[model samples]
Target: MIKQTQKINFGKRSGLEVYPVSMGAMRFPEMDKAIPLIRQAIDAGMVYIDTSRGYGDSEIKLGKALKDGYREKVILSTKCSPWVFKAEDTDDSSADCTYKRILESMRRLDVEYLDFYQVWNINSPENYEKATCKGGMVDGIRRAVDEGLVGHIGFTTHDEPENISRYIDEADWCEVILLTYNIFNQKYKDVVAKAHEKGIGTIIMNPACGGMLAENSPVIADAVKSAVGISDAVEAGHRYLKSDPNVDTIICGITKPEDIESTIANFKKPAFDAAQISAIEKAMNKLSPDNAKVCTSCKYCMPCPAGIDIPAMMDVVFHDKVLKVPGIAKEKYDWLTGENNKNASKKPSECTACKECEAKCTQNIPIAAEMAYLARREEQSWK
Candidate 1:
């Protein structure tokens, strides 16, 4: 049985102590599978549970799992997207409208009050303005807090680091902030530190870069092994985030019992010291010139006119060449282009070099050229 280690105060302002690793219900399995996993996590000391209205039926599944006295043991959180509501209809951000949505979430989760309520996906300056404007979603959540229907209020974001920092500075009422940060992308390092310095809780989402870091990579494995003497990339990724003192907690999207077990086990292991972490960082930084050119799989450049999955193809190229893991890349390529896969789009060879996707790329990647190269590689090596 996994034992709960000493808990830490989540933030100076939140007044809630929690375990370092939390459970995210975004990928919760079916009810029978979810109930055991939820109980196991809480029983093993992962007491902070986060869900969102955007995650289909997650709130309902979590609600059912929280029954039988499981509700009292967690710091429950859920988010609402004001932008999604606005897209559906105006006045969705009004205090009454937002409150009704909050109540509906509570009803689904079978909770009297939520521990934390976040305005979801405040990804740009315009989103920030809309959320904080008079009678906005933030105002509506504040009204809920005033009536004791919710506790602390915060926001989740996928915005740039500068914008996130600006939001942190301006949103004094925000007690917590959730954002994506991982070993592959430390762009938010300063933002995490700034939030911590200001007594705002920092929750890290996608610590593994949406399973990219979790995949086998000889380069990553060697770096981690040299630094910490452990070679599991996923464990190394989680450890890197855990070592950041400014990060209050990491939310792992658990889908099965074994996932919870592995997460708890990783948490129980010791974190890398400063020297070790520096060594790992230095090793990763020493990659070839192509390292800077690697795709992050953010999928900003998508929807090819020819229907090619530019990100997946780019990922295959990265793993095969940059990471020196051709086997994994081959497996992914076969799966993506296999005849049996009905959802398979155009193969890399089908790319027409229209350069449409290149225009939308955030990283300024040469999408057409990369696709052509991948197509050549598929012909020469992948069969």
Candidate 2:
């Protein structure tokens, strides 16, 4: 229960009183199992919900949970997939698909109107062009707004900092932007500030940096616990995000009823003082290897042809080389490569030096080379 009364006047350009901690309805279970978690979030004062059409059953599950009067309690935000527009043969076709998707989302959510509708995954310059082109999704969104189906138009992106800043600068019609922001990658801080300067509300996604901050990295966990005087690493991560004055709200995917409770409790915890934050940052930089490229573990470089767990393997480098915790690194590396972890069928050693993963990396990391490094280290280390 966040007691500090931290709320955001989201969409100052467009009008919703949103909470500082929004619920991301991405990882919920089936309807019967998900309702309690949704109810718990509502009870905890999280008044905003963010979902996506691409997130499998997220919208439908949210629709089911928001039934029985829960609908009136929260503002809804969902995305229209870019693929919907890309598949269109003509701009008018794209517009039609956009309108249809909005209606479909409304039908699935069982909602009369949505508070926010986002253009999902605008990562490239071409995406921005398609979004803003005449008779395209943007036009459709405007029409949806005119007809009272959507209250505001927004977007979510995984683009680099410069492009993101450019998008914010150019998108005056967009009232809100959802983006990746966390401890490891604060390069977008200036852009987030710029959005605030332009009166556009910002929502932080991946505040845990794809669960890197949530992992049981001994040095990180200890430093965070000491910084906040708390034992929970997840709570510490949430608190770190909440500490940023520029961040209006943090959207986190809650998988359980207890997750909602923990999220709320964590948000209520006081932000770290300046000195504490400095100390924590210092510890992170000191422990992290200067030689290794920072991998935020966005998992964009996935579905490795050789079936390597590229993201998890990258974390192994951070733990073993940077953090200098070979024991923890070895444990995770072994688990991910072994049959114990159901999803990880292939080891880092199986990397075929295929440059496919590198091509998709947003950070332009030499992912194949990093995989090779991990393989070499694994061979040498028996301790």
Candidate 3:
């Protein structure tokens, strides 16, 4: 199919008119921090709000902020893990076990039905079997839509470019793809092209790649400042992604009210010029490690059955082997997957052969196997 260049001439979807940008409240916003920034994003014509039951009280904070008719303005989206799906096992599921998670999310956000309810992350190696198989999680999404708890269905992934292509092709029913796609990631453009061809909405995450593309990215930052008339480096990153006609919205993880202001202001800035794209990539390439693909410490792949924090583990491996973020990576390795949570929960040493979490990953990562490697290494290191 020829890629659709229909271009989003309008800024609205599922009853919400919005700015091209959206707000993602996943990280901690200090003090009483979350609400103000959330409000600021909405006030700036941001019509879509993305949160999750897994995102550390983000849904509740969004609920508080969206109260008093604030719900009327934008589309609200959240996700359900795919690990809960099963045919004969309908009586129980990770989703139903956590259906209260959704109920609580809605009650807190104060919404009856969500504009979009997504499958959180499908970066797992198992891919289809875990999410779409008879008992897999996608059925739950289909059921949720049938139940009218949600209006549209979508999902987000953090998979490799090639796997992302196959995943999207398989998940043709999904209306949106919340992908961690950026200029630095070339594998996504093909999948994104497929999405546009399908009329499915596209949302970009890590547009700033975990805040690593800030002022320190002087080369790309300069190009961005010059192109978009924005002084902040993060704004430059956002602008680079916005210029693409296929992108429906960029979900920025804002931890402060000022981050909102900075993001919104970038939207008002001019579009990218030919020079800017070159400069942006070049700067990222320069400031970034030779292989920026090193673990970014983004816990997108959480809820490890073996109790491994996949991203954190990747970070430790990446830092020690790649970016070298100092002793913090080693410290994280000890605290996160270590005995710290052993009594409270299963640790990385407990991975069952089921590989349930590996199926839904977007990056198409081999999570279960990686955890095995991690466990083996831990024993070797005697930590």
The candidate that achieves the highest lDDT relative to the unseen native structure: 1
Instruction: Give residue 284's error in model 2 in angstroms.
Output: 2.8
Per residue, candidate 1 scores C-alpha lDDT tens digits across 1-383 of 77568788787879888888888888888888888888888898889888987788899888988889999989999988766433235436566777878988999898999999999889899989888999888899999999999999888898999999899889988999999887767778999999999888889898876665666777778877887788897888888887889988889889876777787788777888998788766666655334556777777777778988888888788767787667677878888889957678588888888898888887888888888887887888854
- What ordering of candidates by lDDT runs from best to worst? 1, 2, 3
Write down the worst ten-residue block by lDDT for model 2. 84-93
- Tens digit of lDDT per residue, candidate 2, span 1-383? 43326566774675666777879888888778888778778867777889887677888888888889999888888887655333234423266678888888898898999988888878888888888888777888889999999989998888888998898888888999998877656667788888877888889988776666655667667766666566666776677777877778888788876666667677877887787667656655554444345677778988889988788888887777666567767778888877746576477778888799898987798888888888888888835
Write one digit per residue (lDDT tens) for candidate 3, span 16-89: 33457777868847537767667767767666778887676777788788877788877788875634232233
Query: How many pairs of residues collide in each model?
Result: 0, 0, 18
Top candidate (TM-score)? 1
Worst 10 residues of 3 by lDDT: 1-10
Score residue 55 of candidate 1 by CA lDDT: 82
Q: Give me the runs in candidate 1 sitting further than 4 Å from their true place.
A: 84-91, 287-316, 319-321, 324-350, 353-369, 372-383
Model 1 lDDT on a 0 to 1 scale: 0.83
**Ranking of candidates on TM-score, top first:** 1, 2, 3
